[model samples]
Target chain A: MAPPPLAALHSLGFPAKRLADLATMAGLSLWQPQAGNAGGRVKPTALRVLVLLGHAWEDQVANTWTEPYTAWIEVAALADHSILELIQRARDTSLYISFTTITANRRDLAGEVLSMIGGRRRLSRDSRDNIELALHEALSNAVLHGNLQLESLSGLSVDALERFSNNLTCRITDPDFANRRIDVICDIIGDAVTIDVVDQGNGFLPKPRPEPQASGRGFDLISVSCQSFRLLDGGRRLSMRFPA
Target chain B: MDYAIDIKEQEALVRLTGRLTFNDHAKLRALIKEMLQNAAKRQILDLANLEFVDSAGIGMLLIAREELSNLDKQFILRKAGGQVKRVLTVAQLGKLITIEE
Candidate 1:
């Protein structure tokens, strides 16, 4: 059979339930192929990517998230292999956020994300090491403290566990500054850009008066070098503002 | 907790593996000071085998050096290649810390 025309595929339509709200909260765009290739070709709008994904390819589809203008995708093609792989590959074209959320011992994920964000990703060798270290710490807390309380995602079980995954949750509080949930705001004024991170977690633990052990200090790298940092946890905020 | 620490009591050679992020700062700082106290007035620490060092690591290094300098001690740095060295350079420590070979 001849390949379906690219224009034949129409945007997905839905019953307009809480999907829209969820999308907004999660920061993502949902697209699904509608009907079969022939049905989509004829009526065009009869089937949409998100709906088709929901009905026909639920197993092939993974959770999606969005941040501001970008929707992050977690695409997995291992199960369907040949048929669905080609379909998903042809479905979209842009920056893929698949690997960003995956936490592994390898340090490539952070580097990939920094490069994707198109910011000043070039850190000194030491800073690069520090950034990865911080990332690991954050990921560890997210997985251990946050997700550890939740049930496992499907096929992602250990021991006698069996379940499909749902939304990921994070604790609102953690002692580490780098592990805090923060919104980094970048304001560019003329030739300079001011980068600020608004965190929901507590600021640095109070400095030790009796000269504490070096191994137990937290976020020492960022604390020392980041132009300025202020904690307003009493006011429910921890802000780090620096010249970017 | 997959980490290792090696300290040379005299020359300030501290080798660390695994992570040295903010969460581990308390431990890192204490280790650094401990090494400094047992070292010569001048020291060169090697971080070549360190797997990672986060913002906390950076802070400790800077603050520790300041304290050491105040005590008339010079803590030189040595051999951190790849990502770690790049991070050090970006953090402006490449100029402040002596990067030996």
Candidate 2:
């Protein structure tokens, strides 16, 4: 038989005692970087786990383990079971889910939603691909643009994108910005799915893309993939409907 | 994403594996710089092992194409399959880069 969950975490090199303490803390934990370990390294396995959990950032290659780590692991812990329930709820019955999460980017949440919906629905390859791509754009926009309140790339050039990415890394670590919440709601009816990603930051109107450009493609991708999409709450809420 | 580049004659072949998203920006930039320094007449990115790509990845590819075009060096994509191919197609990158079968 497989080892118990806690045992598995221990075998994976997690601090079992710390994990237990955090569990008791009920999804809240304070992390402070250990003294004399400023440049410490994270194990490869732990780094992979953090990436899969969406807790690692793009610019964290060298500093993967350099900073203090704090997380409410309840969401990460539910990967296995939540994945199954997500699909079952969509297939066997109507499914409605609303999740509110801190501003830290949670790409896994979007990945989970897509995987579950794909498993339950018999969508054509094109349709499935479109939905996955569109959903990713939506989630990215919600986190980077909405909650983080960062402007999209000013130009398609490499320099511009690099600057945007660097700014993102710094902004996500700020409590004033990182503490904001992104609300995701998914409603599945029969074979169709509608998802709304709402953010608390000030919203903006999407300008028309008169030509091919680097930024602002999020709206275009969503429009092409879904049957219809509307910007509501002055762009704070993006609701997209994918047809069966 | 992770990449390995092989140089043969005037052409450079790069094999990319793993998800290519915003996370790979720095690595991708360094790789592009390396490709530019090689002074190869042509560069081909092979994506058969690539599993996923996001909008930022697409933009990076465009940047590569534009930079190469400025140097009059040929840049092409090869062997993209599965989701990677789908995303490339959706982004209409074929209008700017050569995709080889």
Candidate 3:
């Protein structure tokens, strides 16, 4: 089948130069519904793949376009290589979202990603719960240990917990840590959907905690929840596969 | 996550609603403090309305349990259903804390 037609949309304040670069990289035609039509207007439903440059475009597309589209990409996440992969995978529904550590901390990213994918594919209740749990753990690891470089809570003591909380507050407020990028890439192939949570930080390997403790169950939960998973990029990237 | 606590003479029942994750650390800390100060000997967390929980949320629950145990108060998890219940089971939380149906 021919590749679905792709269009790029941006919100106010998004750089036109970057949009043009993205359009060139992905061979996407620009669609500015908000801008008065100099050329004939194309109906939103006609576009099969939308590359959204800002959060506002997401809301606008959701509200204005009633028909289901093949896939959508958040432009913030467009690395040169990932952009190429996204074009290749656009034939299958996929999503790429990248956000700063502060944004990830503030938003329910796992839930939002799940809801977005749920719109494209039907997920069983059990599968949905499992994916949500695994994705939540993966994102937490990315934002906390991966991006912000916060250590796992040392112990269950109130004092230890207090110190951890203080450090979390400190790191999240620091722009150096707060502005680190976290990328989530999702691709659907056949009956399985693979989601990768990638972070820019010093990578980490999970340590075994033989004793019952307050922390360190993130990996355990992820292992049990997903069909299979792997830690790549020196543990900076976690890829999880789930049944759709 | 948000909670409503009812401190009775024998037990303090805290109903936790909404999703619990690492983001709720501050709120969880405050809840732990409240549970520690309550006069009741048993602290129960009602998880029926808790729609979801992550591993970090599980750790926070462990913190609550440990803090209460240190104070010679019993910590119990009650009415965990759906995702919460499944997570509690997968984490083997029942072995560490008392869980009531």
Query: For candidate 3, lDDT tens digit of each residue in A17-39?
Result: 87677667777666654454322
Interface RMSD of each: 14.5, 1.9, 0.9
Task: Write candidate 2's Cα lDDT for A76-162 as tens digits.
Answer: 233445523432322222222333334237445566556546544677877777777777888788778887888867765668767
Question: What is candidate 2's CA lDDT for residue A185?
Answer: 58
Weakest 10 consecutive residues of candidate 2 chain B by summed lDDT: B62-71
Q: Residues B1-101, candidate 1, lDDT per residue (tens digit)?
A: 12343445445555566655544544655665565566567666677776666533655666556667767887777787665675576566765666776
List where candidate 3 sits over 4 angstroms from the true fold.
Answer: A1-6, A15-26, A33-93
Every model's DockQ, to 2 decimals?
0.09, 0.30, 0.82
| Model 2: how far residue A193 lies from native, Å | 1.1
Evaluate model 1: give its lDDT. Answer: 0.39
Query: Which has the greatest lDDT?
Result: 3
Candidate 1 lDDT score at position A237: 32
Ranking by TM-score: 3, 2, 1
Q: Sort candidate 2 into its docking category.
A: acceptable
Judge the docking of candidate 3 as incorrect, acceptable, medium or high.
high
Clashes of each: 54, 0, 0
Error of 2 at A117 (Å): 2.8
Where model 2 places Cα greater than 4 Å from the true spot, the runs are: A1-106, A118-124
Q: What is the lDDT of residue A172 in candidate 3?
A: 90
